[model samples]
Target: MKFISWNVNGFRALQRKMDVFAWLQETGADAFCIQETKLHQDQVQFDTPGYFQYWNDAVRKGYSGTAIVTKNEPLNVTYGMGIEEHDQEGRLITLEYENYFLITVYTPNAKRDLTRLGYRLEWGAAFTKYIKGLDQIKPVIFCGDLNVAHQEIDLTYPKNNNGNSGFTQQERDDFTTLLDNGFVDSYRSLYPEQTGAYSWWSFQFNARQRNIGWRIDYFVTSERLKRKIVDARILRDVIGSDHCPVELELSEYYGRHAGR
Candidate 1:
């Protein structure tokens, strides 16, 4: 099975520039998850013929949001973490399949000067607890723009960027706690020594052109599903937003070890 995750940055803006449906078809993914949609259900209209679309739109218009377009319908779909404090921005969506739970999250970004850093950390703790609960029931496949670099190798000039919003010590430690709780960072697990493999780039100073980017987007699976992951990749060539898509391919029909 194939799955792809991308942070469109702004769904409407991307649609105006390129054919999203055509691109989605070309990938032939069983599921495609997106973050930073920046749209509410009423703000835009998009459809995929064979896919079941699920959306979690922020209460605040033109802000953070998430969605999943999957060919396979989920048994259940959940929006947000169920905490009143955390659900307002519509940052998470959980789709429960027969074998596993698929979660797409748009983690809160710590604003410039670390203004939102405290809230970001709180959200991380709540998110970790939520995913851990799912892990107990079944292995989970979670992906999206987590908004943190996690390590020095994850971004260009990490030394200079250290303590910045996305590379802060607090954020990285929170990410560590999540991984310690039985999840595998799929891409890093596959290419631990690989560098310049980034998914999100800044629009400033021609950052994307220079490949000065951060590997903040991710596909993390329960450690038990490690063997089933055939490939995890950064799709740097495909473009519409500042971030490109990331992909994961799993062995076919591994039902027993697959979904929930």
Candidate 2:
């Protein structure tokens, strides 16, 4: 099975800019998950054939949201982590299959001045706890704009960007704790020393063209599913948002008919 994750920034805006459905067909992904849709349920309509659409929209219109378009129908779909505070943003969605729970999340960003850092940390802890609990039942495959540059190698000019939002030591350490618990960062695990591989770039200063960016998006899975991950890729060439799409291909080990 193959999964694709991208932060479209805004769904309606992308629709007007390019052929969204055509691009989706080009990927040929079994499941296409998107973050930061920035729209309400009634705001946009997508006619996606050969796929099932599930959306989690924020309480506020034109704000943080997520959605998944999957070829296979999930056994169950959940909108959030059941936390009222966290659910308000529509930042999370979980799809339950026979073998695993697939999640897409748009982690909150700490403002430039760090005013939201405290809330960001709180959300991280709650998110960690939520996934760990799900992992206890079955394996988990979660991906999205994690909003943290995990390690020095994850971003360009780490020294100059230190202490900055998304590159802060505290945020990085919190990410470490998540991996330490039981998840594996799929891309980094496969390409340990890969440099100049980033998913997000600043719109200003020609950052994307110069390849000055940070890899804050990821495909993470339960440690047990590591061996099943065939490939993790950053589709840098595909342009729609500040962050490009990331792909993860899995072997046929845990599909709809796996345990049968």
Candidate 3:
């Protein structure tokens, strides 16, 4: 099964910037998870004839949100972590499949001024616990804009971003704790020594052209699902939003890619 995850920045805006439907048609993925949609469901006008769409919109308009467009309908679908305070923004949506759970999350960003850093840390810890609980039931494939670049190599200008939101010690450590707990970051697991492969880039200083970016987006699966992971990719070239897509292809019986 091929599962692709992207923080599309804003799905509504990208519709005009690029053809979202055509992009989806070419990927041939079982499911597409997106974050930072910045739009309420009523605002989106997508009509992918075969896909079942699920939207988790934030209570605050034009802010945080997420989505999952899948070819097959999930057995059960859930929104948010059930933690009322954090659920208000519609930052999570988990689709339960027979073999696994697919969670699309848009982690809270620690503002540029670092004003939201404390809340972000709390959210991370809660989210970590939330996923671990799901892992107890079955394997889980979680992805989206995690907002933190775990290592120096994960981002450009690590030294300069050391104290910054995405690279701060606390954020990185939280991610480390997650891996230490059991999940495998599929992209890094497949290409441990690779570099300059990023998913999100700065809109400033012509960063994308220079290839200066941070790989905050990810496809993290339970360690038990590692061998089933056939391939993982960072689709840096197919850009519509500031963030590009990251895909994970699994040997089939999982979905449309099921007959291999």
Candidate 4:
């Protein structure tokens, strides 16, 4: 099974630039997750015949949101973490398959002045606990814009970005805690030494043109599902968003383990 994740920045804006239907047709992905949709469901006009579409829109207009499009129907679908404090922005969605649960999240960003840092950190802890609980039931595959570059190698100028919003030490440590618990960073596990590979780039300073970016997006799987990961990719060439798509291919072993 192939799962792809991308933070579209704004679904509405992308539609004006490219035909998303045509783009999805070209990839042939089993499931695709998008973050920062920035629009309500009524505002989205997508018509993918065979795919099941699920969306979680923020209460605040033109803000954080997420969605998942899958060819295979899930056994159960859920939105948010069920924690009132974290459910407001419509930042999370979970799809339960027979063998595993696939979740997409758009983590709260710490503002440039670090005004939202405290809230972001609290959200991270709650999110980690939520995923851990799901893991106790079945393996989990979580993806989308996490908004933090875990390591120095994840961004173009780590040294210069030490205390920056997305590259702060506190945020990075929270990411480490998730891995230490049981989840595996699928991309890094597969390409440990690969550098200059990133998912999100700043629109300012001609960043994308210069390949200056940060890999704040990810596909993280429970340790039990690690071996099923066949490949992970950073699709930097694909356009339509400030962030590119990241994909994970799983072996047929997962298919055979269905209905577990």
Task: Give per-residue CA lDDT, model 3, range 7-114, as digits (tens).
Answer: 888888888888887788888888999899998999878998999999999999999899999998899999999999889998999999877899999999998889
Scanning candidate 4 in windows of ten residues, the lowest lDDT window is 251-260
Clashing pairs in 3: 253-258
Candidate 2 ranges with C-alpha deviation above 4 Å: 256-260
TM-score of each: 0.97, 0.98, 0.96, 0.98
Task: Summarize candidate 2's per-residue lDDT along 128-165 as a digit string, tens digits.
Answer: 99999999999999999999999899999999999999
In candidate 4, which residue ranges exceed 4 Å CA deviation?
Answer: 258-260
Q: What lDDT score is found at residue 122 in candidate 1?
A: 99
Model 3 steric clash total: 1
Error of 3 at 255 (Å): 5.6
The candidates, ranked best first by lDDT, are 4, 2, 1, 3
Q: Which candidate, 1 or 4, has the higher TM-score?
A: 4
**Candidate 1 lDDT, 1-260, residue by residue in tens:** 88999999899999998889889999989899999999997888797898899999999999999999999999999999899999999899999988889999999999988999999999999999999999999889999999999889999989999899999999999999999999999999999999998998889999999999999999999999899899999999988999999998878866444543
- Quote the positional error of residue 229 for candidate 1 in Å: 0.7
Candidate 4 clashes: the total is 0
RMSD of each: 1.3, 1.1, 2.0, 1.0
Error of 1 at 70 (Å): 0.5
**lDDT on C-alpha atoms for all candidate structures:** 0.92, 0.93, 0.90, 0.94
Give the local distance difference test score of model 2: 0.93
